[model samples]
Target: MRGLRKYLTPFAPDQSGAVSVLYELGGIIVICDAGGCTGNVCGFDEPRWFERKSAVFSAGLRDMDAILGRDDRLVAKLVDAADKIDANFAAIVGTPVPAVIGTDYQALKRMCEKKTDLPILAIDTDGMELYDKGEEKSVSCIIYCICKGKI
Candidate 1:
């Protein structure tokens, strides 16, 4: 396995300002929630964190949409919002409900990318894992993939 240094170097001290730089360049980071919940993982009440850090776009899914497996609306909303925001990349975060419906996030990602000319990331946050565990696993996976040149 490669050392952590290889992956961490891409996001080092100097590059710590990259996200803000991207933001200034009209890059966006959308956080999708089908569960109608909009708050930080740490329960911070500040909205500016998301606004200042990245262009955060949200899509709250409806119960009917969940039951019928009709994620087209959500995808359309995301694509439209991303286009309007002129985002360079989008990150779609799933909730428990959408996971239960088994929405094809990969397909959604492709669709969104096609429509908006932006890379899309799908994050699955449902079932047996706690939030911290899910976050750790996601970060580890991203790191490993980056080190392997898969991202």
Candidate 2:
């Protein structure tokens, strides 16, 4: 994905860019939303979805989950997915739901770090930003992974 960007959608937001970089990283990229963001990434944004598979998932946050700020439930879900899937690392891709609820990515990262063996990445990208911004944070995550020898 370095020096190459291909997005079929007309307006690819940060969520799209995050999934783009994460798609090639071989780790689980969990979209921290109910469903819309994950749908956009798998349905159209990242063209690679149709060609290959990646560990992309939705938190399946219900209305009360977001309203009640249920970070524990999210951590449990992430840990469960980690235990079930074979992945190099795990990334929590932010979306409108967590962004609106003011989810503390650091806390979530720490929480996941305790229960899981894989490295955790927290990309706090709101749906409001552009694709480049998402790529920026995701690329930084790549660097982090590389530095930690997880890549």
Clash tally for model 1: 0
The runs of at least 3 residues in candidate 1 whose Cα sits more than 4 Å from the true structure, single-residue gaps closed, are: 1-30, 40-53, 140-151
Model 1 lDDT tens row, 1-151: 6664532212111111222222343445444455333344212423346555556555667778678867677778877777577565566655555666787777877777677666665555553344444455445535654685545
Candidate of highest TM-score? 2
lDDT of 2 by residue, 1-70 (tens): 7899764433788988888988987888889999988999899888888999998999999999899988
TM per prediction = 0.61, 0.88
Worst 10 residues of 2 by lDDT: 5-14
TM-score of candidate 1 versus the correct structure, residues matched by position: 0.61
- The TM-score obtained by model 2 is 0.88
lDDT against the true structure, each candidate: 0.52, 0.88
Highest-lDDT candidate: 2
